[model samples]
Target: MYTANNIADFFLGRYAAEGKITPMKLIKLVYIAHGWYLGLTGKALIDENPEAWKYGPVIPSVYHSYKHFKNSPIRCEHDSEVTTGSEIIDKFLDRIWKVYGKYTGTQLSAKTHMPGTPWDITWNDLKDRNRSSLQILETDIKEHYQQLASKNANG
Candidate 1:
């Protein structure tokens, strides 16, 4: 099981050893990788905010589709040529490391194949997973932000 604290530490350490990376950026990267995986593989997201799909997970395919159709006159390629569709699937385990790079002290892993991502998850599951006190996962994300702020200040 991955706690938010461990995730914060993992991201902070990764960015510290490399270059400047905001927590939001880190989250977005992870979200993108995970999102792309789910969309292509017919898996689901914990949060199906269709808006997010426009930016990350579905962006590359959508881009390819638009280009294929729009440039059909000039370009001599068909849908099959551009559709290495599964390539867009989430090799979540590997890509996480690639985006964040290497880690030395602690070996961190996420259950990308967990029962339901933000989109696929139900209200009951969300309440049970994060404690019913909060209505949504964003609440936990907000708390993580506060914790990151305090940690950065102290260290």
Candidate 2:
């Protein structure tokens, strides 16, 4: 298990090296990775909970950490200590980058905002309320992506 910061740092270390990653993109990648981890292993990759923000699912800690970048590409010094020292986790992160890292922040946001997605469900559930935050349940994420994995495996 990793902290959300650990996963965020992992992505920053890999993708931000090019200095082309915005906070929005980084957050989305972290959320996507978390979803896939749950789908693949029935476990969460990070302990921090994600809230369905107007943009998409966001880990508040990570959002604050990188929010300074705003819509600009983030600049950071990579830290190796963020890793969990697990080969399995490293491999899964690599796969996540390979599969989803190529997309722009807008593209990733579109994916997360798709109808019936965890973000979508949470957002819809709370859109009319005066609430400032809506939690995207881990169970919903796991089940949704697990079904996606199943479909991919079958077809």
Best by TM-score: 2
Off by over 4 Å in 1: 1-16, 45-93, 96-155
Candidate 2 per-residue C-alpha lDDT over 22-138 given as tens digits, one digit per residue, 9 for 90 to 100:
888898989999999998899988998889888889989989988988899988888734465787888888788888888988999999999989988889877565556588888
Task: Quote the positional error of residue 93 for candidate 2 in Å.
Answer: 0.5
TM-score of each: 0.27, 0.90
lDDT of 2 at 94: 78
Q: How far out, in Å, is residue 130 in model 2?
A: 13
- Candidate 2 lDDT (Cα, 0 to 1): 0.86
Model 1 quality (TM-score): 0.27
The lDDT, on a scale of 0 to 1, for candidate 1 is 0.35
Candidate 2, residue 24: CA error in Å? 0.5
Clashes of 1: 11
